[model samples]
Target: MPIYGSASVAESGPQATVRVPATSANLGPGFDSLGLALDLYDEVTAEATSGTAVTVEVEGEGEGTVPTDERHLVAATMIRTFAHLDLAPPGLKLKCRNRIPHARGLGSSSAAIVAGIMLADALAGAGLTRTEKLALADAIEGHPDNVAPCLLGGFTIAYSTEDGAKAVRLDPSPRIHPWVYIPQVKGLTSVARAALPERVPHADAVFNLSRSALLVAAVSRQPSRLFEATEDRLHQSYRAEGMPESTRLLHDLRTAGIAAAISGAGPTVLALAVDDAELPEAPEGFEARRLDFGSGAEQVATSRRE
Candidate 1:
């Protein structure tokens, strides 16, 4: 669990402030519809001053594997954020500590995209509303499910239409618990997405539509008809092909009477279980974590020179 702290420094001033939570999407049949904000986090600190270089420092996840230069995810997105607003790069220094695992079904890249954009807006003194932030986030992430919950918190139902995106925030009550089972390997979002077929049959579409509605109803009102509401016949099937462990976990969980769904385009499964279930809270058997559904994203200042 990573927590991003406040910022205090002397230079140009506070550039931007943002802390985004990791998200689990498509819980059951809520494809591109439902998403939950988790407690794991990634914090970003960005500052703009009079200088010529763009410097980035990363701690945690990609410490040695990633470049600490302009090529970094945060810096690259930061540049895009400011440039989109017609602001020149003012010698930025970015520091990020990542706690969320990368390349997993979790929204790691989405968090970075969001944190960078929000940080840039805050630092440049640019004005943008939460709705505007959602729009930008939707554009960068290419989907609204993950970004919606990360920006708005709780459980969200978001989708892209001809008019852009239509999103709504649902009450992420504490009644239901999320039981996660992460396999030993990380799954790629691109690969999971690519596995989807060009078109689905009408029967499958109708089946998913009904199940998606049931899933939303269950999330909106707990003590839900657990087993029935958490079933899917769409994306998860093909998506699971690339990560067989996810499909296996779902089967095993059902056999144990626990309803489960692929957490986003996942290698991880978000099972419907009581917080006090027989499963351990740690990574012992299948590496799991019990997550609360009510927590959302927050904005906070993170750093500057000492």
Candidate 2:
């Protein structure tokens, strides 16, 4: 018999509630490699249900737009987790209080993926280690950049190894202040990724390497260096064709001596400052908000209904 699971649904333990942080990936030159967790979150509460119906209730972001059944991301993630764990899939009731915006290049999907995996593990009473969670979430998300930071929090550098996807987490400097300018429009990751050339110029690759290293070092110590360190020649320009406003705003912000970059595959622009620089005014239809690096996922509550 399994230590944390039972053969019958009725014997499965209490409900599990998980809060996962939002993340910003790429950070200009570190495409698919660098990410930082944000204070925004998506909270999920999941529990086993009788029969095979999977019901999902979504509030806040993506309310009616997202699926409310097994097709829901959290539910799908749970199903995938169940399959991976070799456990019988059972009915589920999931309530999602989502604050992260969907499809805006802020790692919303990655948060959902992490939430699902956590929910499954929690329901099974499988005490998955942080490493285990990272591995599973990375595999599901197809890259470690976004999911890594979402799972471990702080700033993360991730890459695929022969063994598997792995990441190292670092705390961002207290002096680095983050602001995001979100446009009314949204862009799809698949579309943005598809816009890239199969092969980038070798010089461009070298440019990213130099800048990405500088970015990490700068964010760690020299806050002033961010203006130069966050420069990119890899994917930003390439992705701009689909989101001209985003790229234009990024260029404008940088031209004004503000360290800015397209957030993830964005219509959202990420700007970094020292301490508390006033966020530059956003373009006509965009909204700007200040954010900070976040700690990892938290279990706010767990309860058993007798």
Candidate 3:
């Protein structure tokens, strides 16, 4: 995946700061195609060096589990970006401040990828169009649903084409407040996906199509219509075998008239409510909170030129 663009020179010196938002994918019937960016963030500050070596320091999330050397995802992506631009790889001292939880249905990985790409973008003086960035990040993430929102913010509907991943974004209604219920245990996306059937009934397909179309409306204006719009006959039910608690919680919330769905391929449940609408209590062993939509990545600053 290669993007065509150029960046501004680092007149302020050889450092860049990048920020990307966490993303929630598959808001019910949309499956691997719909997603939204959340307020949570992962930030990276990188300073250029003379050699090709890379060093990373992590704070907050993934402090101990993530790599600190060149193998670090962000570092690797930065290296790839430099190579793609035909620029000599720069050594980097990267500081990552992560707030998004890892492997928990949020787009933590996508955040890192975007951070690296944007780090290179800011350093190269502003390379890569948003479309090109989405393609590169989607290729790394294996889908566009999460990456689209992580790059463009707001609500995104994404699809893959022969050329690459493409997406359209809509500003979600401010009236739409999202409440997420996160279970104590982590659920692997790979495991959840493995639980899905290779095929589904044609009726199921139509069921999803109608509701997914309705979802666009519900997310924007018809808040009361979300219950019907968010209903699905797709992967969620089958994924229950891998994450029964999340499935049960989704059902319980929906039963109470909340428009709920599995967040991404996992054990996190997202409930849609109108602004300030009183939400039900989360079951034991789960944490619930209201999260707002987020804007996309930006270069906050560069080191002041000496």
Q: How high is the CA lDDT of each candidate model?
A: 0.74, 0.87, 0.84
User: Which of the two candidates, 1 or 3, achieves a greater TM-score against the reference?
Assistant: 3
CA deviation > 4 Å runs, candidate 3: 1-13, 304-306
Candidate 3 Cα lDDT to native: 0.84
lDDT of 1: 0.74
Off by over 4 Å in 2: 1-8, 11-13
**Lowest lDDT 10-residue stretch of candidate 2:** 1-10
Alpha-carbon deviation at 61 in model 1, angstroms: 2.0
- Number of backbone-clashing residue pairs for each candidate, in the order shown: 3, 0, 4
Ranking of models by TM-score: 2, 3, 1
Residues 1-306, candidate 2, lDDT per residue (tens digit)?
A: 242233354454368899999899998899999999999999999988766788999999999999999999999999998887887767788999999999998999999999999888887767878778888888888888899999889999998877667889988999998898988898899998899999989999999999999989888888889998899999888888899888788888988889999999897899998876766787798999899898788777877665
TM-score for candidate 3, please give it: 0.92
Cand. 1 TM to true fold: 0.88
Give all candidate RMSDs, comma-separated.
5.1, 1.6, 3.4
